[model samples]
Target: MRLYFFSGLTTSCNTLKFDSLKLHNETSNHVTSNNITDESYWYYKNSVDGLWRRWDISVNSETNVAAWKMKWLNQEPKNILGVIVYLTSVRELPQLNISLLSLRQNLFKPRPIVIFHEGDFNNVNVQLALATTLGTNIPISFEHIRFPTKISIKSKIGDLRLGYNHMCKFFAIMLPYHPLISSTFTFYLRLDYHSYLLGPPLTYDLFDHMQINQFQYAFLMVSTDELKFVRELWVLFQEFLNDSCIKPSSAVKKTQITAATGLYSQAVVFNNFEVSNGSLWRNEPRIHAWLRKVDNAQGIYMYRWGDAPIRTLAVTQFLDDNQVVKFRDIGYFHRREYTCSSRMHSCSIPSYHRLASHIVYREGCHP
Candidate 1:
């Protein structure tokens, strides 16, 4: 087993050991090939009985599209371009307005905005106010999140008070398959209501940059999640890999296996400021199947599993290192974590806020 040292503390992977004996015993019945040396084959052979079984969840294209009620405030953009998505509620309207203002000021060009809300957004005045803030040139759409009866009924976890868990599932699993996004946009950027872009105007369109560079995923910051939320997640992911006969890329396998030895406390992409290629999730069959498996596990509600870690797993498992890019020129702030280019004079947050060990700094910035 490999050892990982973090912050002057040495931790062994064996600290959170998997039940090897149990796994061996469970797979003893399967015939092994004398010359087969592939570890993924063994993982497939050792699949536990009911851990990653298929569920009745309807995650197909048609069913996913029917799950939301979408309305456009203005005519849809005639040309298909990238989109900016915000999953917000009425309580966050003030912050949402500020976020839009920042986007208008910093973004190089006007892109469409799609706002997702849980309940009815029938208030005409509120819609008008949001449209006015976004400016008339930007296409705006409001989508009402209609939780599927099948998925909601299966969420047995009792912590339904704030609906945060629902948000996790929506962003992690459902957003990519939404009809408006899947059919139109080449890429999508997720910026939470509290997230802000705080620097000089972007020198180029971010979406065009991603497409030109052939980047599938991009992020501004990286951080770790609390252990409690992801305790069983790694094991479940392993089971899914084994049962589904999916071999992760070499980089993913190396890092995830090492991190799993601990408790997955290594770096996770801070998804609130994430930009992704829409086709990666929408067109990939293996990714779609993996998403269904995760959704069926009900961990979103059971343990308050956030989308950042979940997306991190997906990125590592399915995408290559070259496909992922780290943004340096854009200054960003969300919650208490922030990162900015050294040349950014207009960044509102102090430089000290970006000192956390987990935050990824631009090339020359010192922590």
Candidate 2:
């Protein structure tokens, strides 16, 4: 089975460092028998041949595409489940390409990757170049989803003006339904372009655990008490639910939103669940309308309204907190912040040595 790995990045010297990690590792076009050991992690295969499969089916005739999908479906693995969904804007395409290159060299198996972007057809060509240059064997596809530059959500902090980065990240929630994304993929992994997987190849068994629990989303749990980010998130989330005609969870209703800065007070984390998709239809339109309403509104524009809180809240609307697991063992690193331990060290690439030092010596809030 050949799985395609996709990325959302571009070709630039400034961002070439991101793909430098690929240089340290060998690039193989096929997985030999020796490489497929008991511990080897395998990804879904793409029986549908050709680079044309990389583009969204919406661009082609629906009847023709449907016939192709039906044929592909027959060859899909029985255990074929989810995909790693990566998002990036046109400008960040170069960086994402670097990430994909590194992923190609590091992992034991290739993953079915969908690069959900906020760009035009030209950007898709750039991604294709990077994928080919990286010499990845997996099937890769790109989907261009329009993101709003302006939004209407009222923020207590100040005027909220979201950029491409913010919109692309949050827009991932809808990628599972995109025409380019196959229904065979039940879970979608939303990772940052800068986030590098250093160690412990994620096995399919772990995905089975995730799928069994009905988790639609997952994230690395970070401290939000200091900034009162989660509290504000709850208040805003409640308003979002009300506007969307969905009911807010009890954890959201009972939580108190206080104006407290960094102090000794411990924050409340909402760990609550029931599985429901009643509000899925309101996902895109509500966010779009709200952004349009607030994009040009007058207020302070010093600080930006981040997507983390909103994204976290969005997952809650679909699944309970128990379904959204926080995995620290993934050995993730974004910038200087990382999850580095003795176990992770064994499987990590050479770059971990330099990056690990910065994390251990530097004083930064790593959540």
Candidate 3:
């Protein structure tokens, strides 16, 4: 089996190929691995002695600039617009099936789907079930991801679990740098395991919509982050602004500052149902610097700083209002938060459920 490692230094973002590892199947309780036995694999392992050490030290060094590089494989994708990605596990397979079914039924056109897991579905039964669910027509690929480990020794904030912090970092930092994803899709939409489309079938291809409009990012909803998790995040952000001298846009200035206290607001872009241009996150130099700064601070592992607020701050600080868009006319639901289009009757959720302080509604939708 081939093992791939991404260098922590931005200057050496090329793929580090280690091809001699062996694949192994484990019992249901153990996380499977393609190259667990290889001693060289320690360099890429998710531990203090592995990639985390390199990631921590390199990002903090002023001489090292961290960036994601695109490395294409031999088999190139053909005319692909975008990919629908789900970071899921064995326990979430049932919900994943439902989500994929919803995409098949509701999307105007089928897009390739990628399922990422932490080496839990290395068996035949799980593979067969996924193939059966999406069927033979749509292109689907399963990729194994390393389990996320603690980057800081500080105590974690709140009651968030390790997996939750992993999800936040994965979406925020790791996903775009993925080799296949970067080489294949122009954009990607991230859907949580519990997220579902509950509207009349999408009338347009979302990828085309963004491409034609030159939009860099789109989100289904906007909400506020918990103050406890993000209390120091703004301070860190302010420090970045001071050091980098990047002026905040009018959109950011208007939304983030409170009227009475003149302090940072807790507003964030809900990213559970987010569609983003791949290059915006992958190729942008300033964005890479900002991400490196945050990672070095250990904000993700220590304070439970979520990708939603991190990306929210990035979009506001770096992008103009025109580059970012709010997606309406698509009924969507995830966890307790949901949005229903007034023009669509396919929403299964009750109308009263639509009213929430965090959700921002537009078009035919009302509070």
Candidate 4:
């Protein structure tokens, strides 16, 4: 397996001490020889040294910025398919600007951007103009998705009307039912309007790995010990999957993830395998109809279920951990929490990315 690192950094962001990993497209100082690693790499290792300690980037005598661009940024991968975002409120416009700008300036090649928002296109256009000024040149299309007026979630607190942001998660899942995506497609990367790409744009190779592994979904796994709601959310997630007629798979069990402790947070990548043909996400009417029932059903609000953990649980029903990959090097920050190692940050160019601090509740993930 080849170990790919991100580049472009002036210094370490936050406490991340290492800075040699940054991939600078303009300078060859970060470029290393292709005579790197030839061994298979497993993402999850229980070593205190962290994967960064083992990363070996050999310095070469001469720099080839053009070749470096060709290898990492010049060509776009076909497997990316498309990128989607669900923006529910106008308040998110500011965050949208930052996210889109980072994407436009950093993404290797332009990919289709589909924005689903309830706000008027006028404001969206304004934001787009700002993003363009920031560097967005990719083709973007927008669709108006109405926010659900009522919440079926019956809470002991009262008739719960989960905010529009929470509702956005449901709309996000509606992708499999959409006309453009097909059962045989490769993969589609989904991002919340607030989530931005901080490393080199993802490529077809990662998607191909997911396809070969038969992964239906991929997400960033959160340490259950760090989240208070993991147990309750997992219980409700299991209930939803059970009601939806999803089956448990051993792959999920291999990770020692229980109904009470599994959690995959932030950016989701859906593969065409089970997601396209299986009963879970692929079952549009059946699952959505079931969701309506659950939404209205009472007693579930005790856990205050969230879409991130819920979707993570749902995927476990049909696929195993083997099919899924929890990325730590992508260098992402939600509100503030950073998942990448110091070496990973070394790859990030600060002008194009921000250092993440402690992770906070994503817009709709918490009360």
> Tell me, what's the RMSD of every candidate?
13.4, 16.4, 11.1, 20.1
Per-candidate Cα lDDT values, in order, are 0.63, 0.40, 0.64, 0.40
Residue ranges of candidate 2 with Cα displaced over 4 Å: 1-80, 106-108, 120-125, 133-136, 148-162, 165-177, 181-184, 225-233, 238-304, 314-318, 345-367
Candidate 4 local lDDT, residue 357: 38
| lDDT value, candidate 4, whole model | 0.40
**lDDT, candidate 1, 1-367, per-residue tens:** 0111111111223333323211121211222332324322111111112111111124333332232233556555655658899888888887788888889888888888888775544477888888888787777776654443333433344445336776787778777756556556778999998787877678888888888877788877665677767757877787877765565555454544555464344456778988898767755555666677787787887767788878878887776556777777788777666677646643556443344443434431223
- Better structure of 2 and 3 per TM-score: 3
Candidate 1 stretches with Cα past 4 Å from truth are: 1-78, 148-162, 257-263, 350-367
Candidates in order, TM-scores: namely 0.73, 0.53, 0.75, 0.55
User: Per-residue lDDT tens digits of candidate 3, residues 187-210?
Assistant: 899998877787678888888888
Q: What is the lDDT of residue 98 in candidate 2?
A: 64
- Residues 1-367, model 2: lDDT tens digits: 1111111111123322222212222322332231223221211223233112222211211222232231211123343454555666666665566666666655455555666554442353575675574464655665543443344445565445455334433442333334334334444455666656655655434455566765444444343443533333344444545545555443333222233542222222211111122123123344333333222221212234344444434443334445445444445556555554234433333453355344531111233
Write model 4 residue lDDT over 1-367, tens digit each, in one string: 2211111112112443213322233232321232223232101111121121111112211234121111112223343343434443566767777776666655555655545554464364564564464443455545443333444444544445455334533432444433223222335556665666565544433445555766545554343322543334445545654544544445344332534555433222222111222223543333344344434432234434444444543444444334445554354545554344223424333443455334432211221
Collision pairs in model 3:
none
Worst 10 residues of 1 by lDDT: 1-10
